[model samples]
Target chain A: MAVQTIGHAPASSSHKGMSPLRRREAINGYVAILPWFLGFLIFTAGPMVYSAWLTFNSWELITPPRWVGLANFRFLLEDQLFRTALWNTFIYTVVSVPLQLLIALGVALLLNLNIRGTNLYRSLIFLPSQTPVVASAMLWFFIFSPTQGLANAGIGLFGIPPQRWLWDVNLVKPALIAIAVWAFGGAMIIFLAGLQDIPQSLYEAADLDGATPFSKLLNITVPLLTPTIFFNLVIGLIGAFQVFTPVYLMTGGGPGTSSMMMGLLIYRHGFEEFNMGYASLLAWVLFLIVITLTIIQFSLARRWVYYEGDRD
Target chain B: MDTHVSPEVKNLQGQRPLMQDHAADDTTARSRSLVVPRKRRAVVVHLILFAVAAVSLLPLLYMVSTSLKARGREFAYPIEWIPNPAVWRNYLTAVETVEAMTFFANTMIVTTLTLVGGILTASLAAYGFARTRFPGRDFLFMLMLSSLMLPYMVTLIPQFVLFRELGWINTLYPLIVPAFFGGAPFYIFLLRQFFRGLPTDLEDAAKLDGAGFFRIWWTVAMPLAGPALATVAILSILHHWNDFIAPLVYLHTRDNWTLALGIRLFRDQYQVLFNLTMAYAVMMTVPVFTVFFAFQKYFVRGITISGMGGR
Candidate 1:
């Protein structure tokens, strides 16, 4: 039957020629995807090339862009604010992403105990994530207000005096990190799904072997959930690096640039300062850092991430 | 007889009898020997979950509490969990203070159009990538997928320039037009995964009946894609509803402000009025929470599918 089917294919169509149906399908496929293709070129691909070109110039949005090769790049190397923004974003991503994932995974495991009220617990935990970042930023702003804020009141109960939260350079990043952690519910739900995908039999087998819960988690659950962990890690890292709205709204990258992030810095240069060229350069730098990190993560994933159906 | 094994687990058990036997034995033995410890564990788990849930909800609760507080009482030490007499009028004041009604109208217009256009364009492109076979299809799809890693910041300045050149600055066009052109790669990828999972027999039958690809996509495939479409719609609504950066950049006049921009402006202008600002924030959040609760299942399914690499 296989040999007959193979023989029929060449008999019906000349070599290196598509049959009529194949050609029609190809046409339909192109027509179907045309909007996305146009969008790619006009919005994504074209703008990317334009931005790269812009990085070489020093246009101020009004005057025609004049090419100045690598001047923006040279200035970028020496710009104190640029370095501060990059370092702040790096610190935020390095600290927050892992912490959020750990908390998310922990909550997901707790929710997966098959206890009653699971749905309610899940909704309650996930509610904060649904709140708009703008609104949440404002809410946190009030909560962190130095004298009248809930942060101080809550800590005062613990006998620790209220320190300046967003105003204090030492505390600003941690305050922002706390806000990011509050919305880990998105990752939590993903982790819950991953937990559910793990076959119960593995857990039952471990139980039958008298494995402790921690042992079962380390040996069975952790291995099975590695793919999910990797997914959250990559996503969280990218998101944390682009931290903007909170900083833009709450601190405006201040208390002396302590919370300055790449996203806000780009916004300031491009929109506020009208320095489109430098802003484009900063954005490209951000793009390169994110791409490099994602590549590294993917390469490292091979050693750790376990896909269930891998032949190896 | 263990109640904890979900139906999905039971389905897995039906496929493997050996594991099923072990599960059975393990459950019986564990239930007999560990009833007391299991009950204690349940209590402990519930306590932990309750604590976490409180932490999650506290800030929101505080927002509500502050929004209703009598004006000066916002900074009252030993934080008031509830207002003495709820300042329900604060909602009215929030609205009156900043053309809140106009902002609502603007936000609704932008969100609705973007939601409809995003779903339409994204689903069409998803159908092409998912259901059709063509040369360079995989290559194009991967190319599109790689764009997901390209930060929006990279495109922000140029797109701003492009829109400025088109004379679209200060208009809603900048925000609304992109959605009609598959602006969201993630949505297309998501809908593609959904389309791929759908059974193809119906599509094949439609083809045999002389229906064209578009007809099949609309009648056969789209009808079956209600869940995914709903997921995309909900996500799109939430995104455009909460979008700050676009409106902040594009809409210069207060007359054209969306709720996000309006609320931010309110915060800036009324820096001392925490109550009114909280009131405005609550108003902006209500719609999102309503949509979320109404379609909670789709949110879970969407996130789950995303985590699985759109399997």
Candidate 2:
């Protein structure tokens, strides 16, 4: 909208008289933002396009890039490790996204109760989100330390046996999901704001009609809050797909690559193995996964996400 | 996106009784009783919130407790919630043991450089998108937006290879340089929104006075954007402070390591020494928590305002 100000520039003749100043302004803007553009060219965009090129070849850093068109993609078609990573990522994404969203929404609803010490609750809840991911992962690693972990100690009071968390092959993704859920406090705050935006009269009217809290939540709250949910879903989807820090720190995708995520695999191939070409192909595949999922979610959201008072 | 709340609705609200009449009747019947239930509800909410807060704080508490626990006591159970003789040396030893001062210096240098670079580049790019109308400007801005959605991991390998080729491996250059160039689209978008919300009269007046864009930006806009800039600065500082992967990938020498990577050194070197690791963890985490508390009011305000601004 601020562009409207520039669009309100004076006519061509007026512009011509001050051409040097305007040109200077343009150049100043360009110069100021030059670092970012240089970064994009040399780092992000450059690497991205190069990665695409690399995907078509067979190259390691030690040798020249051989002209082997689609070889990596062909390798991907039958790669067992690739298939395992794909499956793990899919399972993690599918299980975690809705679960995290629901937990966040529930927490948000609880926090929105206009209770005493709201700020205390908020800061405490958001603490984990602010904690360094590596530290938190390490903390969880200690907590899930098979025998002497606090998790088993606390829950053992209920007479439940100690179960392997990060150690067990099956429990690895769940361990990651638990960590993911702990960070939901941030998303919860966002959803709480969304909840606040809903007209209070809608709730009051529902209350007058003898709508129970549960009914009102299901009928009024969830439907209207879908837009925020959609936003979180998109961001969360992108985030879940790119999850690497926890995987790197906690398990290192261990139990024999059972928890090996696509991102970790990519990192391993590109950095450790120095198979830049194959890694780029994996990145492309992950990119396609995210892009396609985002598209699908956005398209599907039309049916569910209701924007009150929105004419469009 | 913040559409008008209709005048018709406002007038209708004024006309309607709403719950006013019912509330008056109910108040007459149970004004005294209302206080009891309200108090009870407050008590219940507080109790629940307090419990949740305790649960939320447990890991952090454990981290601190473990930091203070005597060596070999990290795994001791019937869980020693209190360390009988607190190992005060853990803090001193942790700091001295790991070249902590050097890592701290490196982190501060990298973080400060990245922070300064991020703010300058992001603000300028934001101003361009917000106020300029060059050819392909809109397309370029869209490109920037699309790039925001690109999986950052996709660029990691290629960028690393490029940095390796440029002899930037094992240096902070790779970590610091790109940040100056608007490496992050999210912050640029955030600042751009803030700039857009600002009144245009200042810029217009500056133009009339023959002052250029940069002059107006420095003299007018920067002063007005103090809060947004503070938000950007704080987030950037925290981000770089916590970044481990970048430093791990770029830095090879132990002396060159940042605090985050330095902390990881403990885990890598002494996997079984939970006490030392926890002590170092507390040392690393405490400062960040302190920083958060210092900027909390502005940080929360920035988050809410940004969300509202996004609308």
Candidate 3:
């Protein structure tokens, strides 16, 4: 693609195959996209290579990187905070992703019902998803305020006493998870779109076979919706792992590192502490985990993520 | 700013025809029998949906009530669902405290610039992928898609370093400049899908009219891509407006903070002023909501249409 565009610039420009206008068009299109290409090379691709290079060193941003092959890796192996962050990220991802997908599927299924003003229900459910996370986090900060928050007030109705949401280290991740679940509208919207695309013929066929709703869901809908479900799940997992804003806003990664997400930790190192090299190492670790998990997902997806239209 | 009209769609006229046609066919075809049963069931189902809708609106309702309540009444025991002495100063105080106008100005600048840069970059790459038929185009596109799986956490540090090198660390440049370069691959892919779906005839006609690629894209393709472009614009604005981490990383001075960052400061600095905080929260949401409701039809239409094509 690069060659063809480059070739079209000079080689094909001389072929009389096109006018100056065509050549100009080719140049302009490439020019318009050049910023991103340059950015990818300088910012994205460059950092990726530098990150790998930094992974093997103990260099700070000020000093030249000292090649201490495998030392940073070994240091990370023994780093307790890295271990905690990794475990927290895993626990957060595993707990949140499936729960989110389940809730999203449930909401989408409910919205799928033929009903009056279903659009209103969709809009309402989708409202939280669109609300800026910073705003939502602020709202939740008050809502979960240990003393006089609404959540505790509401839960008191069910007789559960007040809990320190962001204050308690153990409850912090769960609190974040509960807050994260509120934004299931993204997954729900995707699932709703997916649900709409399911051919009615399948349901009719299942109904003719005397399949109950549960049976039909199990035999048809679940299997057919797997592709979308998989997509939402994978994306949700990646997003959940990198979740920083809410943690940053609601907890400041505190009451002491409880909400210190990988993203936050990296931010602290690279930006706050100016330890770009070490932060790059942490970033690389995060990249490896995401890639590995995503690969595993795609591999397992073949077994479960059914594309009903693709009848081989 | 109009609350009734959706931002992207001016008239329901576009979708109304199809819905009416479907409804008509549905009634006529099913009128022979079982229509009454289905309609009865659908009515019952709708009531249930209405209850769900009410449940969903509860939080917003709570926020409004809290915003109205006087300072002490906000946290009063046996919590008041309605404000006793409705305090209008909540809005005034919240707006006054955080330099809300400055924050809004900053937000608008960031959003507008990001939107412009994002659209230019995304559309350019999309056009390349859609029309060029170049070698490794598919491969490069796939590479972009793979990058989507690489969490933002990965490239963040490197990006910070690159920005620091360019002396963009404390400016809006880091946030705005990268946007001009296919920063978000998802949107680029979306634009690519939309571009591919558009018929080639228009561009060809433009070509025969002695127009170049840029001219064809701008005059021919863009005019026909109102809904898609609106979709891209709305998504870009929302992303830029709501972004927190990038600004938090790149911005050092308090004056440069975006609304999202400003809101966080409000919550932290005024921990006891629950009513004012809620007011701030509401103010932040109102504009986005207004934009949302204004272009709701187009917003939903764009989503459904974009999804159908993109995936």
Better of 2 and 3 by DockQ: 2
lDDT per residue as tens, model 1, A1-312? 112223222343332488788788878988989998999999999999999999999999779999999899899989999999999999888988898889999999999997999889998898897788888999999999988699999898889998899999999999999999898888898999889889888776555445568867876788889999999998888878888889998999989999899999999999999999999999999999999999999999999998876733
Give me the runs in candidate 1 sitting further than 4 Å from their true place: A1-16, B1-31, B267-270, B306-311
Query: DockQ for the candidate 1 complex?
Result: 0.44
Q: In candidate 3, what are the lDDT values of residues B162-241, reduced to their tens digit?
A: 77778886788888877877747777877787888898987998889888777777888778877777888887787787
Q: Ten residues in a row with the worst lDDT in model 2 chain A?
A: A6-15
Which numbered prediction scores highest in TM-score against the true structure? 1
Give each model's whole-structure lDDT.
0.85, 0.77, 0.73
lDDT of 3 at B230: 84
What are the TM-scores, per candidate, against the unseen true structure?
A: 0.92, 0.89, 0.86
| Per-residue C-alpha lDDT of model 2 across residues A103-143, encoded as one tens digit per residue | 77877787887777787787887777677776787788888
Top candidate, metric lDDT: 1
What residue pairs clash in candidate 3, if any at all? A1-B135, A36-B181, B5-B294, B6-B294, B6-B295, B7-B294, B7-B295
- After TM-score superposition, the amount by which residue B104's alpha carbon in candidate 3 deviates from its true location, in angstroms, is 1.1
Q: Best to worst by TM-score, what's the order?
A: 1, 2, 3
Index of the highest-DockQ prediction: 1
